[model samples]
Target: MDEVSPFAEVLGQAIYQFTLIKPLLPTYGHLLVSALFPIYIGAHASLSKPSSAAKSPKKSQEDGYESDTEEDESLGDTHKMESLAPSDALMFPLTAGLTLGGLYLVIKYMGADLLNKILGYYFSQMGMLFAIAFLKDCFAVIRSFFFPRKYSGSGRIWKPKPAERVFQGARDDGSSSESLEVRHSPLPGILGAIPLPHTVRAALWTCREVAYWRARLRIHVHRLLHAECWLSVLDLLSVAVALPAIGYFTFVTKPWWLTNFLGFSFCYGTLQFMSPSTFITGSLILGSLFVYDIYFVYFTPLMVTVAKTLDVPIKLLFPRPAGPGEAPDTISLAMLGLGDIIIPGMMVGLALRFDLYLYYKRKGMHKAQAQGNGSDIVKPVYQSAMGGWGERFWTRSVTPSEPELEPPYHDARSFPKPYFTASIVGYVLGMLATLVVMQIFDHPQPALLYLVPGVLLSLWGTALVRKEVHEMWEFSDAEEEDEDSSVTDAETKEPVEAGKQVSLFSRIFSAPKEGSERPPKSDEANDESVDGKSDKKESPEKLELFTISLYHPRKRETSKLKAPTERGQSPEDDENWALVGTAERDAEPPAKRLRRSPRQH
Candidate 1:
């Protein structure tokens, strides 16, 4: 005992700490899968536009970017330029390492009491972030209602109108000016097209018209009474109610489900607002996190300690029931971080959406074959209702307006079911594997280490088995080319040619402008600008082009992340679009999206 070395003492302490984990692992084992279920369900069902959709030119104006001064543009440009240089991929690792290193030094030199202060500050900051997330979720719901199907390039609040021929056919301005048309009616045109009995159709039409007029009346009355004032009042009232409720739940009552629900809402809404654009990008991000989680949980004490002491809803917890003869309400909880579920679940959702797209493409392929003009088919609107036999016959399906069908010859073999099947199975297996390791070692392990490998293995292994590795890796080439063609054709089109007004629903989901406040400048203007001789006076064609760019959806193009820029100045514009476009690639098949099962959400 007197001759015991320092190394032996440290080893003894490590063994002692590890020995204590045996009871803890068994206690939490029952909670592993159930705790993760909600996130799994929510993320899989989360249908969101690409994050870039938020930057849509119309959205920019809606979000108050229309009033942005020249100073703001200058600032944005500077920020954009700064972001253009390639940065370190390991930035997160470096920042985390430094912060933790500094904390360690402080704890070792100063004392545990000082460490408590730092942790308290950290948790406080985290709570504020959570609160902000809650607010964002609330606002997201509002935006979704106002801008339905924004992510899928459908349902914009504003539609562009071509110049109306006025008196003498001469407008005040020499160049034509476009006006925005607001869609006041909430009902679909497909409702009118429904193949119901005349009496039934009349009743439905009456109901819709009555509803629309009622809304119009309400809007008019609200405007007469200053709607903005009332809205501000409502906002204040909401804040007043929210603060007390938040405080009561967070501190006074401290209900687990309440906090957890809020946290889940935040995660769900945020993920829905900003989604992964591609399978590969999703995989890469998940892979990095897998490594991060393993290192933090296994190699260091930080993750566990922070998780336990933080006492926040960042992780979901499920309380397991007591065994026979034990206390009835003993709280043995199983816990999982939000990230573990969300990251993998996103891939599942994308695969599922891809399955729907492929299903339509398969149908469109048959239709294209029958029509006998697959390659040059500019617009193929397929209307086949899905549901109960009578209902299918009675109701008309709403067809997506853009993205013309691809030919059968170029159609790649798509096995969407396998991707989804493998991902879900791998997730469950990975969860079980994580528990098994914990049970064996009697220690905490990172769930993602198993989860990431499980998902990757399942996805890639299924691809390999189906001999679709290359196809899946290079999925949607035809779709991508079509989208590209649409964008190119759109840029080259005469504005007057774009005057045909699409229905409201079509305009919403149709590709309007990509990004930017102003339309793309013509090559002549571009040359002039380069030579310092750009004209202040815009040609009618340019005006017409701008109007077309603003209002018209690109022909045969699917919804993509990159459209056009507002001012066409941001350097990061293209790279950012590329990153987000990958997420939206799967959502663009020109067919009615299958109505999601209520149970899934």
Candidate 2:
């Protein structure tokens, strides 16, 4: 950084500017992102790829950094960092608090903006890190809710461990044919958004628990008061309204009120996915102008305001191992004011409530019409009222059906999924409500964050989906056993040429053309014929190559004559192969002791 043409002077000057702003960034939490990005990335990578070491192993140690604090770890060893451990999450925040005061001191000694850029780069990397996990969650949500596949072959094969038993029951008592598919957790998607210290994640989770109780309390009141709490319904509505508001803020409008909204979000950059409920609220806010356009627009001036208002002194509590002229860069922002997050969040909530209002009103209208015998207006009374086209607008139909639109599935987890479409509608409404709430709050601003809650709201409707399918299944199961039986028969009639494309990695190491999985000898016992002559049996070598996973290590069996007792010495521990009993041995010749198929000619 120091040696290039005018680079050293330019770099020094940038650091000088960064020093100016570093003091104030802490009030809004952008400083934390700067401080922890590297560690977050390292920790995330290490956990994601436990088998792989850090790129430059020595460099990581020299940096005195480990992705995970020993305390953050517990049961969820690989994918999750948890334990309901609240105190552990506080470690990063507490350390960050102390470091704020020293930030300007370093800035004075080193160049300001120079340090800022350096820190900025790493935090940007953290965003990328979180993004990867976010995308994975996105894909998983899609796979689980839509385009679901029943995976063929065994679920997984861990070396020297028993394979997962996806199919539990055997053929006799009618368990093997049960239709079930195991789905992996979608937790990582929510976590990717809130990359924090262990304690912070825990605290955030704790906060959510608290929020859920509050939401539940509201539900109780609604029920007791006969006001229709409809928790699930409201959540979906909020998301729908929030989405439209988000689109509005992001693309439609840029009112003067927008600046405050954007200013606050950038300042408090804890902008990632959280749980779906809160996320819908947050999504509405994000869809507001603050996130997209308003961000770059007011960023600099906001920093100046932050530089003036934040009282906390900045410092470098943990200094980096320095290069010749490296100085740690910190960030400052406009204000501690949360107008951005709060206003939009409220907007989403209001939208959800309003949608609930409209929904009940519509249902009431529906009941009134039914009482008056006006139910046949929408389309065919049976299809529109009883069954099909009128119910599922997501479905494709130019004309309408007279009967119920969708044929329900037997499985609870199986589709016509829970709240997905409803949530989208909820998200859009949440966005709208956010705008309205902002107007009510004496600030009619339009920023992009307004849409976040709406998106989150969109997911709410998904929760009830499980019940709907379960109902359909119950109906079918009670209706007729033969319907269920037919579905089962369709699944297991294996095709003559099954599984041509898939290949197991282990098979490559074996001799070419060897049978992939020769079934245990017992399953293929020779059949007796009414005639004396024997039937020509198919040889094992000609069996189609299908992969059977190897998880457990093959433990060599010992012979009775040469078995090793406990604490006994082993000469070589070579696998002991037992010679067949004399009666069986006499049935086959010594030169070629092969499986005989009852005298095949």
Candidate 3:
């Protein structure tokens, strides 16, 4: 909670007030689920909840996920309400009082504006990226729905008519669940080519065969991402596990503290065939988040407060230009004092080591077993690199040390994001890739022309990585078994209830019914005004804020009492103020001033 990413801190404000995943927290929870936070980590963490199905990864005891289940059950039963003893509520006031007081000191006394601004810029960019991603997906969905023939690979370009109708989403026996055409791509002649854009055609050719380049990108990207995520997880786990369960020491850096783990993800991604730009770009982003988390816990409140005291914008330290008449938004350098450094430093150190422990634990567990985890289990490297199950199993059993193919498949996708997205986010991202390549090669920047690659990449990803583009299915039968499992349903389900109570309105209304009218008391209703003539009316005090100034000095000034200036100007004195000019008046009793006022009139 303390070491949250700044991106999250920025996005958290809006997200918390709206979403209800971890319902108790406000926007802080939202920041907990931002782009900087590799979605898989949190999503996978949530997966540890008690599953009815067996094969899902078991929850670690230290994580409190298991305890959460019992607590939820205990909390849900209305009969237990009476059992809430005095002790439970006793500390509540202390926690609340301290929390509010701390927040006030941080916001009012310290300074929150500076922190808000830096984070705001980062999160705004995050929001834009998300918007682009959403638009891409929307376009894809539309193309699929409207121009199914063109979008589906079996269109005029690739279509090879089958003797029988395909009735897709139906039984293999050709029974119709929904009527659909069945056709295969007409294998174009070796010399033949399609009329798509050159880049698109090249990408299509590269990826369409399902052989070399297509799978390489996927494997490499996954390896890079997974390794990096593991690094982050280890860094965090060091602190998390130690503090809560095992006694944590004040010091907690890994023995060889050079951060080599980040490279694991990138290297893995590269081996899998993900774009180098992607590996680097994703690393840059997550790296920022990691640093931000460390920084916020240590410096943010102090920096802002110190900046205010100094009457300097916190940003001035970074030496950026300031606009005229604008107050500098500053975070205080003073905040990074000794205590700030020590406490958070310890926490971060512990987090890193904890992740290392976890990796070893998993490895140790695998060692304890004899037959080894099945061939189907994904290795840390992407599967596309090596030969499929049979070749791998036989090789391992016979001459285990001998390497088979040049790009031996590693079971893991280093940064295993959902396939469809990895395939396509490439299009818009390809532009970024080109920039990186140019920068790396010290070449001229491609302007409009470089956009060609993005378009090409997009089409390639779209055709090959679309929903149901399960190219690996043929190679790994384990996936088919997983699809049939209840675990899959739980993973994909929109319903938040994990075999627990679900809101009636959410269950009934949000379900994909043709027309479901459940209740008006939804989130939208919550946003409505609070009843009666107006959903809300400004509190009487809110309409106008009044200020009263009392004089308790040795000099008595009865007539000096006067109403505050209307529009910040007193009717008694007619004066114009200028830039760098002061507003001043002689001290006098109101009676005395009243008598003297005739001269002014």
Candidate 4:
């Protein structure tokens, strides 16, 4: 027999180990799928409707009043009210530490039994609400899969003519708008040529009617599912499906499958709704939690004890085979905490968004360049791939309005997701490393210890390689400003009157001297003040200037202002005169300056 090579021996050993680990695959599979679902779904949703992700402060301010009215009529608010700021990221570790310590102390003193009961009751109620929401979302997804919204309201029976097309309703004037054009295949001509019987013709007519009705039914179902109401058919169906699951989980039995289901739902909801607004915030959060995980897992017994004692769905559990001398029916379990999945999952989600930002930014730059060069840029046409007869029967042949207007990069599937891909690969490797170490040591491992480094290193390394570190650093999801307090600085061409300058200085410095506040303005100064007010009102353009108080004594301000051309002095002479004037004003006592109004100066 030929001797086995070292590589062959290694490969054989790996296969043997994998076969031994086959039973644990479900546990890891659940963890991986649950962790990735939210990121994938959230990124797709944001990319599909890019407008909802971020809005310019200028646009928001300009449309603020209109948006207020629109909001009242809108079905739902999709924009996040609060995002994770950098300050929040800084404080998160402290807050988490306090909570963990408190929980540990409570469990140590008050007993885990009582604490678990109270927590279980609370979580059950909360989980019911979340599960109902999850069910509704699931129903929507399933409904869309069968009767897509893209094909809604486009049935063959309601087909419209090119020139004059009318939907179901007629105009108030009561004129018949148009007639539907029924498109039939050439099968009838082929049948006639073949000299088919009349019964066959009747059967063909029946099939045509069936096809038309199927299209009508599909359109109706799509409309029903997508209706914007609290108690639509879809909601009713979701409630119907959710009620039994809720009852079983609450009353019947909280089986491992049910526990895992609820845990996955909770993870999905959290990642979908909440996000660290920027990569820096995500990194800070992960870094803090990395230390938190290490402390809780290895240094103290709090984490392991709490995880094992708590009967809630906070951690995912997988059953292992009974050990030697144990009861044959007994089950030993392996557990992984939800935090391990969610904490690093946030970074992965942010990476996907960062990818999207880069994609759109590049697209905009290319479009601008093309426009600059006066090139005729062709818009891409999006077409859905053809499917079987059943799929074509349900979905309309007409292209959806949204896709028609969407650019080529609008679809999430086609996006160049180097950062997202890298993070996902890193996560898998880290998780496998964690499992390997756990197996070797015969101890539980804090998954985040490996996960955090894997995610962060992969993301930052990809950024360094791509030379996009600056772009990632600057990317933010927070709204820059709200409409109510929006104000921007404007540069003004108007010269600062000497009186205005003195008044500004007075405000900056202490009040005028104690005994010299008796001087009043003359009639000429009053006339000049009235004339200046008239000139301001008569000017066509009114610019609002936002000022910041600087302690530099107007040195920079003087340098920035243009000298008066009417003075007929050289630039150097004007500069010297301005400096002299400013110095004299500064040297002159505030009392002296206050004796004359700014108009007099």
Give the candidate number with the greatest lDDT: 4
lDDT of 1 by residue, 299-367 (tens): 888777656544555677655555447887786566677767766766665555445444555555555
Per-residue lDDT value at 447 in model 3:
24
Question: What would the TM-scores of all predictions be?
Answer: 0.45, 0.21, 0.18, 0.58
Tens digits of per-residue lDDT for model 4 on 312-361?
87877776676558997997777778887778877887787677666555
What would the per-residue lDDT of candidate 2 be over residues 327-444, giving only the tens digit for each residue?
Answer: 5453212222233333333333322322322233333345446557564322111100111111122122222233222212111011232233454355346444543454345332
| lDDT for position 352 in model 4 | 75
| Model 3, runs deviating above 4 Å | 1-237, 240-601
lDDT by residue for model 3 (166-277), tens:
1122232324434454323222322122345556544543333221111000001111111100111222333443232211111233111111121112222222111111
TM-score of candidate 4 relative to the true fold? 0.58
Stretches of candidate 1 above 4 Å error?
Answer: 1-36, 48-245, 321-331, 374-416, 476-601
Candidate 2 deviant stretches above 4 angstroms: 1-77, 80-93, 100-112, 144-147, 151-601
Q: Which of the two candidates, 2 or 4, achieves a greater TM-score against the reference?
A: 4
Q: Tell me the whole-model lDDT of each prediction, alpha carbons only.
A: 0.44, 0.30, 0.27, 0.54
Predicted structure 2: lDDT: 0.30
Candidate 1 has its poorest 10 consecutive residues by lDDT at 77-86
Q: In model 3, what lDDT does residue 529 have?
A: 27
Query: Of the candidates numbered 2 and 3, which has the greater lDDT value?
Result: 2
